[model samples]
Target: MEYKYKLAKLQYDKEKNEELIKRQRKRAGQVFPKQLEVEFWQQHLEQARHNINQYFWSGVLIYFIITVLMITGDYWIIDRNFFKHDFIHSLLGLVNGAFCLLTLFFFAHYKILRPYYAYAAMAMIFWAIVSMTWLTMTVHTEVFRHQAMMIISMIYIMGFVLTGVKPFHMLLTGLMAAVVAMIMLLTLYIPIDVMVMGRVLVGSTVVGFLISKMLCTRERMIFLVMHQARLSEKINRIHAEELLHLSQHDALTKVSNRRTFDEMLDSYFEQARHDEVPLSLLFIDVDFFKKYNDHYGHQKGDEVISAIAKSIKDSIRHMDFVARYGGEEFVVLLPETDAHGAYAVASNIFKAVERLAIPHSQSLVDSNVTISLGFTVYKGEADIFKSDFLQRADQALYRAKQLGRNQIYYHTLQVEEVL
Candidate 1:
């Protein structure tokens, strides 16, 4: 029973996030949706850049060594008379290494050109696969041609491992290698065994295709799940904050309600006691509000209350605040204020409500809407606790009703002592 709710909550959240990702993918025309734009690109680029940087120098060194060995081997050991055609083919092979280095440099120096890296990387990989086939074309030896074919397959699969943090890049490179290798073998006059080479090519490509399909599936699943968790947590936070706000406020009047007022009362009292400051509270009631609601209908009553609340809230100083204590009743709390300050605020609010001129045909006081107010201003008295001020204000409001309907009254300290 202890961890039951926690496990249930986790399950519920996972399901909800999965559904969110599914719906979002339907709407996502691009690789990354608008909300996850920053995260998606940041992760993708970081992985690509890290791998390119880590392997770039080592891969370049290997390419340079291979290029030098090819040129030197043709001239020194194999061919007694190396012609211009051999020179041209070796230079052409060296050009592929140059393109590889160029791709590395583009990634290192130019960050703003992020969109081009994928194309540049793909082109470099495609060149690596095809360049060896072309380089061995001029060499009429069976051994060199066979060795070159093996090198082509090796580089083809290596391209897959080299492409990091991408979904389809490895697959794309693998497909390109297979297509170009087969096309060159069939069409061009490279004196190699068609049967043996074709079999090896198909085998390696099947492995590459399997590797590509498997890796792409796993990485793509992880990426989607990661994004869903990030976005769902953000959405949950927003909803939680909204719920907290709704709980603390009156939905109808858009003001702080009784629950919030009660919390503030406790806090303000503690602060006032510590600082040896005065605290004042004003309670306001709409005069004959029940009759007003009955006569003018509840909708009009709601409008009148809203208008009166706005007037009261606007008329008060920023330091002093108000809340709807209950139905047609509002409380204003003023800290560090004496009797004079409380009276002034109460009087202003009373006048402000009258000035609204909302036709209150059922109000007993006047033709327009009016309010009766009673307030209590308390110094830091050791004998008095926080709740004493509320009682004093209530008693004062009762006396005001007994006397008349639409006037302001002050519950003095002398009356409290007398009681």
Candidate 2:
């Protein structure tokens, strides 16, 4: 009977060892993908390029429509019944269309030649002056007088509207105002037929230009105020988001803090439960961290922690999360990862931390920095609750600490089930 009892005890030990080996093999089968950071910024850059293209094409369409209208108006110049003769009317229409097309091309093709659009607009205003002079000097019919005056007035108003569309192009506005003033002054000396009509139209155009300028100034002031308000609101929002992030994240390492880790665990528990997917959690404590702090001082200790966090970030896939659970303690969340997968991730983290090799003179485990990890993985319809999963990992961590504090451990039941 005594020999039989001793044999049974030896067989139990052998089965337990085999189960542990089987669990390790199962975990080794799962591989973690490499992490990449550049993909995030590329998405935003593409969106900005798309918006610029859209705005440029819309401006081109507006210019095209204006050019078509000027071309059609040129046909009316040939009718002698009209106020102006065919030659003068066609000249005005052609000048307007040509300038409009030139401005459009400068804006579309050579963005660097934006200043040239103002010069082209100035040329258009010069033609307006010349047209008004010819209408007063050569045209004799009373019917032509009112028509010519109306056309000059329309040209001045159109120039003012165009200035509003491109407010940065001040040269265009100044040239148009100078032309109107010159035509008004020229009427005083020329004494051509219908001098009164020329003076009245010039005076009205100046008044209209001044009113439009005033309106533009008021609109700009309002826009500035609105812009400032938006800037202030945006700054406040950014500050709020930063504050929230800081509260939930480790200041030294920029990883999720202990409170955030707990909150995330609760959230993942619910999600995994609903989706019927596996969830794994890792409890990692840096081995001999106290000795490291003692050897390097608190400042260097902070740097070591930060470096480890970066290493963990580099090793894990984007879908996995790494958080600073507490002082020298870190946690990882692996969605859709089973017990075997979790052990594989934990082992990789172990290797990553060991490779850091931050010096610690007082450490019993090693003179260089290292980590001990405990992990748990749960799958569908398991009788285990979240607390049970955490307890199992915590127990494993305690065992690793007892076993010289540089190794990883998993639950016995999980290991046996795997075996």
Query: lDDT per prediction?
Result: 0.72, 0.63
Model 1 lDDT per residue over 223-336, tens place: 778856765675576567667978998887878999999999999988888888999888888889999999989999999889988998898888887899999999999999
Best by lDDT: 1
lDDT of 1: 0.72
Please give the distance, in angstroms, between residue 326's alpha carbon in candidate 2 and its true position after superposition: 1.5
What TM-score, over all chains together, does every model reach? 0.58, 0.61
lDDT of 2 at 218: 51
Instruction: List where candidate 1 sits over 4 angstroms from the true fold.
Output: 1-43, 46-210, 225-246, 316-320, 336-344, 378-383, 399-403, 412-419
Instruction: Put down candidate 2 lDDT per residue, 379-402, tens digits, no spaces.
Output: 644566878877877877777888
